[model samples]
Target: MRFLAHTECFFGKSRYDDLHSALGNTITGTGIALIDTAVVDSAAVRDLLSQVEIHFGNAIPVSAVSVLSEPTYDQLDDLAALVRQSDPSFILAIGGGSLLDLAKGVAVLLENPGLARDYRGMGLVKKELRTMICVPTTAGTGSEATWTASFIDDQTRIKLGINGPNVFPKYALLEPALLVGSPRKVALSAGLDSLVHAVEAVSSPLATPPATALAVKAVALITKHLPVALNSEEEDSWSGVQMGAYLAGLAMLNSPGGIASGVSYPVGTQFHVPHGFAGGIILPYVIDFNTTRGYRGYELLNPEMGSNRTFYQQIEELYGILNVPRNLSEWGATGEPAIRTLRELTLNQRSGSFNYNPIPFDEADLNSLLHLICQAD
Candidate 1:
């Protein structure tokens, strides 16, 4: 059982203020703050920045950058160049997964030579990165707890991850207050993304007992809280989803993702589907496929549903409640041509999710799955 550890996490309702306090006490140098464009103007962000200003009292300057969209290699490189000019001692990333990923890429690029595309694969970063603190405003992607930073290839339009020990953040701040007013669709997609992470981690061939335990608990928490969190403003419900997402991320560090994760890349990059939605939409299908082939890994996720309903049915029912689409067709990734493109792209990308899937998934299996999901509904 191998486990890679990094990122000390602090969780609570308004613990985001702790980031400012930590920075004030420990660091005397300039820092860079990356804010998600969607939430940069929110009162929460404004208050945090104000607190930082008060704490520093002009002794240490912090530059704030607005980040939007899933970063492409070119975009990452451009951002890196801009951030390099500041030469910050640390980086504070506040936003969703995309913004956090952009911050991670920038942190690595500051210490490492070459373009973002150069470190597209695993363990390519040769140097230690600048200290990074991730504060996620969404409950998905688990970017805060993971060592992989995702980016898109500008030329190929393929989604790839820059993975290595250096990619791990120094700290993760999980403040549920940051998630209070997220859009309904955004919250739903993020919650479902965490759900997919837990499901895929438990279904991975490399899953350790510890990882399985974390993933199982994550599944239970997310399943119980996502609906309530989406429909209401209760901090406890949001907190549950947040903790579940973080645990799912930790689980994924030990146990790689499965077919659903592999398929999400192509679907997300090609169809412009949100990553979480892409994975969540395909998860139920993958679960059914695996169960029919006698794979019982998911049975541990929801034992209470029993043999009568099956774990797949439980997830499918949740999808109904969440309004998740049945297949890729809803995202316009339809037709045999699109499926062929996605299959080739998935193979070419060589996502580890394929290798780590609970069942043996070859080209034939991938092709079949693609067709099954891409069929018009």
Candidate 2:
């Protein structure tokens, strides 16, 4: 494995010093999580301190350094209050998927308290958390790359993201080459996950102009280079991977993903399927089912979108592009009892996908949806 360091600190406080005062944050504070990738040195800490000082007119205290492999919500309770306790003007997040997820959790934690479960599901909270600047290293998860973070709720054994337009990061620092050394599976899965984000967002219920553009660009980039991703080690593959991944990020910048994602979390965690593959497994079925409602227009939003196939055929073509199995059976999910449960969980997940479906589904629609998934050979 190759290791690289990306630091977010202050070299010149003067740059942001005036900006901070304008925000009326003269006594700003900085929140740091200690789970960074590189060796932590005094130089790094000093630079961070200087940046905070430049903004707040004084050095902010670095309190609550928690270390973990990635981001977690189980860290501290009363997140909003904890941030208020420090009363920092800025929160700097530096780490991988887990850390970025935790930063988002903290962003929520600081605003609200008591059972994080209280805030589960879409658009539950509205108030923004502390000002945050996220710097991503692995290029996977693009967690910093986006506003929401997915964290596992150990109590429920399900992973849920901190949802809300407010949670989108104030800004993210992405260096493409940083993704080169990542594990092959994680890189592929993360890249594919972005495609789902782009697709669902474009076909989503609200289908905003900005979101459609993002999803289209994401599809073009991902389709163009997935083969190179699987086969080549060329240095420029970094550019392909970076472009595809960023396009995925841009996909949800306007609209969030659909039901496949909503229901896949439980299915994936329960069945131990990688989230990306599991979600992708059902994407075509959902699209085909949604066809009853005229989802074809969604595919045309992109200048270089798929062509020549019927909508369902185009969806099948999409699966070929993703390089995952054609059905759950291919992934070893074919027991009668297991398939039954799988169908049920997937039906449950369909609710989250409401925005993108061309038509609304009732219990019977879910039955049809499940039947398609179970027999998708």
Q: Which candidate should be chosen as best, given lDDT against the real structure?
A: 1
Residues 1-377 of candidate 2 have per-residue lDDT tens digits of 11111222221224354334434633244454323444133353445446545645554444434544333456534444465566555566655565666666676666665556666766776676556766444434556656566766666556666776666666454444345455666666666666677677677766677667656777767666665665665536655656665656655655656767665675576666666666776677777777756657654633464465564575566567656675566555655666677656655644655545657756676555556555646
Residue-level lDDT tens digits of model 1 in 1-377: 67766888877744646666665566557787888777877887776666556766653344455654568888889999998998898787898988889889999999999899899889999987788778899999899989999988878887788999989988888878789878998888898888888988898888888888999999988988898888888989999999999999999888888888888888888888888888888888788888999998777876733445689888888888888887878778888889988888888875556788777778888888888778898
Which residues of candidate 2, in runs, are more than 4 Å off?
Answer: 1-91, 94-98, 110-115, 121-127, 137-142, 145-147, 233-236, 290-295, 298-322, 329-332, 346-352, 360-365, 368-377
- Compute each candidate's TM-score over C-alphas: 0.92, 0.69
List where candidate 1 sits over 4 angstroms from the true fold: 13-25, 51-68, 304-308
Kindly report the root-mean-square deviation of model 2 from the true structure over all alpha carbons: 7.6
Error of 2 at 332 (Å): 5.4
The root-mean-square deviation over C-alpha atoms between each candidate and the true structure, in angstroms, is 2.4, 7.6
**Cα lDDT, model 2, residue 277:** 66
Residue 127 error for model 1, in Å?
2.2
